[model samples]
Target: MSLLELRAVSHGYRQGGLFAPRTAKSVLRDASLQIAPGECVALLGPTGSGKSTLGRLALGLERPWAGDVRFDGAPLHDRRGRIAPVTRRAIQAVFQDPHGATSPRLTCLEVLAEPLRAGSTGKAALRDQATALLRDVGLDPALLDRLAHRLSGGQLQRLCIARALAPAPRLVLLDEAVNSLDLETQALVLGLLRELRRRRGIAYLFVTHDLRLVKGFADRCYVMQDGQPIEVADPFGPGLVPPAMAALRAAILPALPGPRPLRQPAAANAVLP
Candidate 1:
């Protein structure tokens, strides 16, 4: 069974204010995708292609105007129209902006500990668990007391990753999670995510505009256009490319700089100043 699945789901937002007549602004139309257990699936498309909306639907953050979202062959929400506590913990999200994901007023220790409060009651045990989570994400436990604003970009991103993992989620919705970081930081965070997936057997829905980001990381790649996913065979391999894939591939800047020719030395016998 698929760990997460969206079946012909359509979603939209309301437009126009009161007195102006409200209308539905459709963002997704019969869009569908799936993520299997421990699989890394990439949702690749340009901005406003409804990739993030699809992710939100999968995470139960938004209800689809049409179709259904299923987890392990069951409806994602209960009869009361709410995700069960256990189900909510089974899924988590880490968005692009780390700072926005957390509050500047809260300390790192508190941010990480909040999720664990359900099981851990004692203060010392919670602190220990938070410290271990920090270390697991390659952060220093000593920085736990610092406010969110005090951490660097890379540090803040990793801390957010740690917070997402606090519940030991089965699937993580990573929506452009590394797109804002520098190249070096992006590589480091990707490596950390790969390691964590290996150690914990977590599935990821990596949503991004850069197809290059999915080259080695994703088991399967889906190109989104017109709010629907078109599966491509061997994204970087030799074959016919879908129009959406071609467009996205063309948008990716060269990952590495080309080699420059060495300057020739002046003739030794030519002249002396």
Candidate 2:
């Protein structure tokens, strides 16, 4: 069975004046997708295209107005039943901003320990697990005493990833998780994610707008347009070869510098009024 499945799922937001009858602005329209165990699927799209919404749906943050979202053949709705505590630990997320994800008041040790504490694990075990996770993400165990505000953006992002892995989740949702980092940092985090997946057999739903990044990083890619998935393809396929999708492809490639203005022949050292 697919690890995660969204079958004909649809969702919308109720907006406008509350006094008047509110209208539901649909963001997802019968969206269907599936991710198998140990497979990393990248969801690519422009802004307002429902990529984040779809991630939320997969994480059981929002209920679909139609259809069903299932994990291991069971629906994710409350009526069907809440996800078991053990099952909940199997699905975790790392969002776009690490600063926002990590508590400013918490040190790295505290941040990583929180999940284990919540899981009722012993403090000694939590410390060992958190230290190991930090090491796995290429961070120094000594840095664990530093507060969130003291770390660089890249370090903070890695911390968030480590925290997500603390529960030993089988699937990790990365919702534009690396968008705010520099190119070097982005590459580092991406490499770390890939390595972790290989070593741990963890699956990922990588949502982002950079198709170029996905081209080389993802095994498969799904394109979303206006809240709907328009295309899905293998990274090596012609799915991104069409003219209509060219813009997205181009956006992902290394940006070229604009042409430099021509010099005015040095003006012969004369001053002009």
Candidate 3:
């Protein structure tokens, strides 16, 4: 069974001033994709192509305007249009900007500890669990004292990954997870993601514009165009990508500080926000 599935989902946003007539801006049109347990699936598209919106759908963060999002064979939104607490805990996400996503008032320890609130373990062991999780994400336990704004981008992102893993989620949605990092940090985070999946058996739904992000990691890649996922292709296959995107990657990628990817163009290493 698929761990996550979006079936014929049509989503859009309402835009306009309160007095003016509202206009609906369509973002997704009958778009659908599936992520099987233990599989890494990547959604590739340019910004505004609805990739992040699709990630939100997969996370149950928003109710689709049409169609259904199913997790483990059950609808994500109940009749009340609320995502159940249990379902929310089973899926987690790491976005592009760790600084914007987290609370500035909370220390890393406090933020990471939030997810443990849903666990069966008593209060006594929760701190220990937090420390363990930081280690699991390859972060230092000492850095827990720093607030979100005080840490480097890579450090803050690693903390976000630790928080996401705190609940032992079945699926992890990585929406442009490494896009903001320099080449070295990007490589480190990518390696960490690979290790996390191998060690935890957790599946991934990667929302990205850089196909290089999926080349060696994902089993399947879904390319979005025209407000929908238009093609599904194997990451290792040729003739699956648009020529323009390939050209941009070739022309725009910076000189990487780390070793070059075997299959991706240098533009795949761009530190795009």
Best by lDDT: 1
Of 2 and 3, which scores higher on lDDT? 2
lDDT of 1 by residue, 1-273 (tens): 899989999898999997899999998888888889999999898888889889888889888999999987889988787998888999999999998999999999989988889775599999999999999999999999999779999999999999999998999999999999998999999999999999999999999998768977999899987779878878777688788888876667455356999988989787867
lDDT of each: 0.90, 0.85, 0.84
Instruction: Report the C-alpha displacement of residue 229, candidate 3, in angstroms.
Output: 1.2
lDDT of 1 at 58: 88
Evaluated at residue 89, the lDDT of candidate 1 is: 94
- In model 2, what lDDT does residue 226 have? 57
- Write down the RMSD of candidate 1 (Cα, Å): 3.3
With candidate 1 superimposed using the best TM-score fit, by how many Å does residue 263's alpha carbon deviate from the native? 15
Instruction: Report lDDT (Cα) of residue 65, candidate 1.
Output: 92
- Sort the predicted structures by lDDT, highest score first: 1, 2, 3
TM-score for each of the candidates? 0.91, 0.87, 0.86
What's the distance in Å from true for residue 37, model 1? 0.7
Model 2: residues with Cα > 4 Å off, grouped in runs:
234-244, 253-273
Tens-digit per-residue lDDT, 76-165, candidate 3: 988998888888888999999998889999988889777887776665688789889889888888877777678889988999999999
